[model samples]
Target: MIRGVLALIPDEFRRFTPRYLALVVLLALSQAAAYLLSVPVLQALFDGNYGDAWRWTSWLAVAVAATAVFGYLQSMVGLRIGVGMLRSVQTRLGDHLSTLPLGWFGTTGSGAISRIIVGNVREILGVFSHLLSPVLNAVLVPIVVAVGILFVDWRVSVAMLISLPLLLVVNRLANVGYSRSNQRIHDAASEANSRVVEFAQAQPVLRAFGATGAGNKALDGALRRQQKASTDAVFASVPGLMVFALCVHAVFLLLVYVVIGRATGGDLSIASAIALIAVSSRFIEPLNQAAQLSNALRSAGSAAQRINTFLAERELAEATAPVQLSEPSIVFDDVAFGYSEDEPLITGASFEVSAGTTTAIVGPSGSGKTTLLRLASRYYDVDSGSISVGGHDVRQQPSETLLGQVSLVFQDVYLFNQTIEENVRLGRPDATADEVRRAGEMARVDEIVERLPDGWATVVGEGGASLSGGERQRISIARALLKDAPIVLLDEATSALDPHSEAVVVRGIHELTRDKTVVVVAHRLSTIAHADQILFVDAGRIVERGTHDELLEQGGRYAAFWGERSRATGWHLAPSTYRSDLNGALGG
Candidate 1:
């Protein structure tokens, strides 16, 4: 348990550990010494040595006082260590989490992360103040008591010395299931936590499919596994507790029998024998505490292991000597990437968006359109080949240097539960209110707040759920406009909006893209006809590259795609279902 606590402590705080442990040792010894001194006090009274008894009583007072002093010191030092640990851990996790590849979140899940950061970290912190002291005392106190007894009554002390290891072995036998059960419980709990989040977040989809309540199998299965794991932990502990109890009782009886026999044989003085018998009862207390704490120690060990595993995750590597951005262009050179190495997503892809040009990425759904824009931003490094911005390899530039030159406005927009002005200011926190208002006007977000009761102070509930999708997109555009980076990456910025709102958002994108290098994963084929270059990606490859008219002249894949889209525009829906102006969205 001490090893586990030390392992989790950061390097800067390691100096405090020795001091903490030293105090704990002093405390344990003082406690044991104080406990054993009772023997002499009892012996003096029994023999009618009143003067000796008073002297022994003064020494006993010193031991008790020493225990209190050492204990107090240990607790103060422990709290300092724990506070430092908490700060270092939380800060490190936050910084490290920011550097990890975005895809890691998709695969690892937020539930597991929250478990490690919230639950496991708290458990590790408790080790210094709560678990460590008791566990260490449990081991140290018994050994001190047994060894110190040799001076008082050798026969009784020998019996205690012999029983110590036997009791330990029995206790060890009882805790065999503890570590394994804790791990199972940890895994089961993480799964259950993830399912609960999933069940809540996917309520709309689940309810749409009539899968609420008992109809949700994934949540049901996860909950069932958690229940079984908890049940198993309870059952696993019973046998160990029973066996340890029997061993402790038998050891107590043996100590009693030994003390009685020795006293009658006259090998032990009557006073010493009585003192030994009383100290023997006190010995059972620490052992019992240790036995009961076996489960907690194992639980803490499991938590430490989980925390270590989380900390070991690799983050995106930064360049040792980073270059400054010199231009606004983005280039991909023969890149190959995959979520897994064996299955490539985009293979041997090469493209360049020169400074002050707009390049549109047009492709069927799931054809790696979004991946291209993501690559340009360097969210995940390519498995093979290189991506560069401003004529320098992205890997040769620091993340801040690279990202500072780019702005992102993806299809999925997220807004914190804050005022409209606050959300816009997230793009440029130091921007004046006038600057934010200008950006809002350009993005047409002024229309959104005009009718609202609170206007700029109106809180947009979680993820902007209170607003329509178009309003959210415009607000996100306002954020991008406020940022005003020289390079922009837009992924279907005008998707899922009514025609009028779509037109308004497109105008905002026009303003955002003006005189800036833009790479757009465009859905509206007709809308991007004027793009300087078009790349038609299919099945993870850029199969066609040209202007809209040039691709049409070739009449190949791009022409066919455009032809399909043009024909799709003729299909109509009722006025209430959708307006005909949704041609781009419907045909995209």
Candidate 2:
């Protein structure tokens, strides 16, 4: 864990590692000089040499001032290093996370990632900036003082050194127990945070069900567990910490006894004994500080391990030499993939989407329809076969190159907490105001924007909470339209819209996909009646493939789906049928 923490220190700061070490050495020297300077001052006063006492006092003041200056510099340098490393690490982690597979995000909740990125990262800052110098001083200053005492009286110094091993044993015992408790506390805190975020996000649903109180049980339970864990951690470590404190105090007592014994035996002078007592008092301070810092180091070690694990997560390997796409078409040749190795979401999936054509995929909820679109977009790599876009394998092309070729509009739309215009502009960051306005007009998002009090400048709130589902969908469509990639993937893009809004969005999609390769996954059978090709997917395979009308004529899976959808589309509640059912139920 200490190694992991050290690894997080950026190389830029590491270049000054020698300077930091030198500072620590200087700090220890300054501390020892201040302590040692007291020796001559005490001896002159005891000898009644007023002139020599004044001279020693002057030197002692200078040593004290120098120590203060060095301490200040150490703090300034540590702060600068800590803040700089924090910024660099956060930025690097954010960039690296973007390159990881989307499946990783799904499996690891946002709450867990945010806790590491925001909370644990700050813990690292404490480890590097605030903790490092003090820990170094604690170790180095004591050794320097011990060496000085050795010259004063070797036997007394030997006794002091013996206490060093005792300090180590107690600290080790305390740290081992504290580390286990600290880990439990950290896990409990993370779980509590995750539950709070989940509850907050689901508040509207809970209220609608009139079960908000009941729904809070999980979050409340998590909080209780966190409280209990925290208490347990403190209690579990207190005994060992008490023992450690007792050991440290005992060492101080031993040092005092040794100093008195040496002075009485005539081996040490009165002034020398007095100086040793003063130095001994200062010496045990560093040992106590070392014991206190042990707990912080253990917590930091745990935090560092988590951060290292996140940093070590695997990313999709980019091609060393990327291949260029020859066309806008997409092809899947015996593609197979799964979130886990044992459960495949897609298998033996083979299909070809020709350039400037529309292909629609339809299936049941867990039939891998959306997964197919995700695979085509390279959100996840295939396990068994290759997925090629524009005659080049997607894995053979760079992510940037592949992403530039396709625009995806998923069923679930997320908008940043920014202006409607800025959200749309994300589709093409360099796009001009006029281009944004044009895309909005095409997607009919302009209608919604105009209704807002701030128009295009309005804040959308987190995830566009202020807007209706269909409004958010139109904005998403506008974004995709502005991107204008040659290949478009749509997953229930119009599912949230009313008939009129759906018609407008459909028109926008049609305009955007004109002369482009399009792959769509839709549950509404009516929406894809005019698709150039329709694939009926079931249980990770395309069970049927043909044009919509052709599939309907075959009377297979697609035909059955169509029949159910058509009946549902025309059916409505009848008063006479409802009355008959009510009477039957009542036996009237």
Candidate 3:
């Protein structure tokens, strides 16, 4: 357990040695003083020296007081150290998470990682405190107690020492069982958390499908697993306690026998025999505490392993040195990517978006339109070839600088449970309320907020459930506008809006993209009729490219798509059903 603890402290702490050296000094002194004072208290009581007993009592009182003060200081020091360590961990985790390829999130649930940050970190803190102090106290206290026993009669001390290793071996074996049990318990716990999140996220669909019983049954199974794991963990500890109890009994017998034999041989006095027995108990006290600590240590060690595993995940690589941005155009040169080894999504793709122009990408579903947009944003590095944003290779530019130049608005929008203005202000957190209001106006969100009960300060529900689909999308656009980046990427931003709301948002995008390099993932080709360039993708390749009229003249894949779209001019029932379900949402 101690080895696990030492391994986690970063090199910064290791390099600066004075602070840790002082902590070690304080811990050693405190443990030694506590042990010496405790042994004398036992000796005075056994000798029946009333005056000496009173003297030792006063000394023990002082020792206890000193221990309390030292313990508090030690705790405060540990807390400071823990906070520093935790800060380092959180910063590193956040940085790594942000740089990880976008596809990683699709494969890994966000909730599980959230639990690692919040829950696993708390467990790690408790582990550090539990493992450190007990180890020093346990080691020092027994040695002091054994010396006092030796002064009375060396035979008793030797007998006690002989049995100590056997108890340690038994306790270690018990620790292994407990550790395995905790691993199962924690695994069950993570599954329960993941299931609850999944169930909650799908509540609307499940309720509509009338699968509440199935959901309940899933939760019940999770609960059953949790209960079983907890029961097994408790069961695993039973053997450890039994072993500790037996060891204590054996030590007690050895003390009594050694004292009686010496007294009968006229080699020990009655008072000395009693003192020796009393002191022997103190000698074993530290061992008993050590036995109990081993249990906590094992539990903590299991938690640490989980936390370490999470921290060990490899983050996306970046160049050792990065260059500055000097241009605003984006170029993809023979780029290729895949979500998995078996499913290639984009192959040998190439495109370019000039500054201050809107480039539309239109394709059938699963033609890599969205994947192409993700590449433009550097959410995933290309599997081959190069993506250059502002003339610097995307992977060779620092992530912060690359992301600072682009703002993305997508169909599915998320808002935190905060005031409307605050959610909009997230793009530029330092923006004033008046500035946020201006951006909201540009996104046509100000009009919606005016009708909301509390206006801009109104609290949006979690993930914006309190608002309409169109309303959420508008807020997302407002956030993007607030960012004021030179580049904007839109992924079917108006796909969720009613015709009226769609016009409003599309007009807003038109104005917002005026001075920016715009890349639009085109689901409705009509929306991008005025785009400076059009790229029609099929089977992960750009099958045609030209202006809207030019593509129509060519009569290629773009013309075929346009023909299919023209044939389906009327509204689809599913969209109408979805809008009806939204209850005439302001943006829907």
Candidate 4:
């Protein structure tokens, strides 16, 4: 686990490795000097050599001061390395995520992904910056002190060494329990984060329904579970830790007894006995520190594993030799697809849209209208058959190449938390100010922007929460216009707008789709009355297709849909009392 985390440290951080090693060596040497100084100082004092004892103490103080300087340098360097790696990894991960298919984001919830990127990465950083030095010192200082003790008296050293294996065994048992509990705690934390994000995002809807309290059940349960897991982790490991401490104390007592017995029998000098006893305390202190750090190590291990797993996720394969498109037309030939393999949402569907024509796809909810558009856009690969744009199979071209020729505007509009102008400019980052304004005017975005206090400079809140749905839709259209791609895909782009806003947006859509090969998954049948072609999708198939008037004249499924929609436009609610009186009069 430690090795896996170290591997994440990029090559740029290796420059600080030597500095850290130097700090560890200096710490161990200083510790040995401090314990070893006690022997000569005590011997000199017993012989009334006060001057010699003072000199030895002064030298030990110097070593300690030097160790402090080295420790400070190590801290600064480690911090730089840790923070640098954190930022680098985050940037790289974000870039990689952007290249992944939209399906990956949908499968991994935003809350879970955020927790991994922000929370788990921070934990891993703590492991590198704060935990590493203490861990290394704990291991290295003990070895240095143990060797120093051996030169004083091998028998006492042997007794001290005997307790190490027992302490290690107890620590191992404690770590096993700690690891299991820590994993549960980590999982619970991720779940709690997800619930918190969900609750926050749904707050407006929950309040409207007067069910905020009821809606909090999931988040509350997750928090309670996390608290219990934390408590259980402590309870599970504390007993083993206590046992380890007791074993260390027992060894300390045994060493003290052996030294005292040897001194009393005149086999050991008084100075040597006292020095060995003093050094024994130092030796065991590192062991205790190492034992306490076991839990932190376990947590870091789990976090690192998650990060590595995410980084290792597969990405969509790009063609080695990508094919270039010769036209703007789209052809779906016997295409089949599903979120899951066994449950196909689109099967054996074939269609063609010539360049510079408008084709509207109308269907009931969940009839695969959006799925078909998504496939055409290469958001997901088709399961069986080909989806070609401009005579080139989407899979035969690089995703970037295929995407560059298409502009997508969907019902759900997403805007970054940036100035309105900047959001629109995302379609073409290098677009001139004049070009942006022109596109915005064409898409009717300038009308909405002009109403804001800052006009184009106004910062939209996250996901454009500050803007109304229609306003956001206009901005999205503006972006599509600015890109000026040959093929435009619309998925009920005006479905969320009010009647007034829909009229303004429809004008913008005309400008965007003019002379462009367009495929619209339309919700409003009336809007597409003049469409060159209308494909009535049902149960994953194009059950009917013709011009708008031709389908209505055929008096089939499309005709029925048109009839129902036409009546729905004039439907109205009447007062119950008035309706009943009218009915009674008619009966009389």
Name the top TM-score candidate.
2
Report the C-alpha lDDT of model 1 over 166-237, residue by residue, as the tens digit: 988888888888667888888888899999988986787899998889999999999999999999998899
The count of residue-pair clashes in candidate 2 stands at 0
TM-score of each model, paired residue for residue: 0.93, 0.95, 0.85, 0.91
Query: How much RMSD separates candidate 4 from the native structure?
Result: 3.5
lDDT of each: 0.87, 0.84, 0.76, 0.83
**Tens-digit lDDT string for candidate 4 (344-386):** 9898889899998889999888999998988898888888999
Clashes of each: 0, 0, 1, 0
Q: Arrange candidates by lDDT, highest first: which order? A: 1, 2, 4, 3
Ranking by TM-score: 2, 1, 4, 3
In candidate 2, how many Å is residue 441 off? 0.6
Worst ten-residue run, lDDT, model 3? Answer: 15-24
Q: Where is model 3 more than 4 Å wrong at Cα?
A: 7-65, 83-88, 128-131, 198-203, 212-214, 318-326, 341-343, 549-557, 571-588
Which residue pairs of candidate 2 clash? Answer: none
Q: What is the alpha-carbon lDDT of model 3 when measured against the actual structure?
A: 0.76
**Local accuracy of candidate 3 as per-residue lDDT tens digits, 1-588:** 555655566566554334543654566455545555655666677777778878877877776677677667666666666666576666766766776787888876655677666666666565445555665566555555555566656887777667666666766776677777877887677777877776776777779977675557776797689889989988888887777778777877877888889988999877666666666666677677777777776666665666676667766676767676776888989998998878888888888898888899998888999888888878887788899889888888777788888998877789999988999999999998888989999989988988988998899877886887888888888898899999988887666669988887877776677789989988676665888999999899998998999999998888888888877866466977787878877555
Clashes of 4: 0
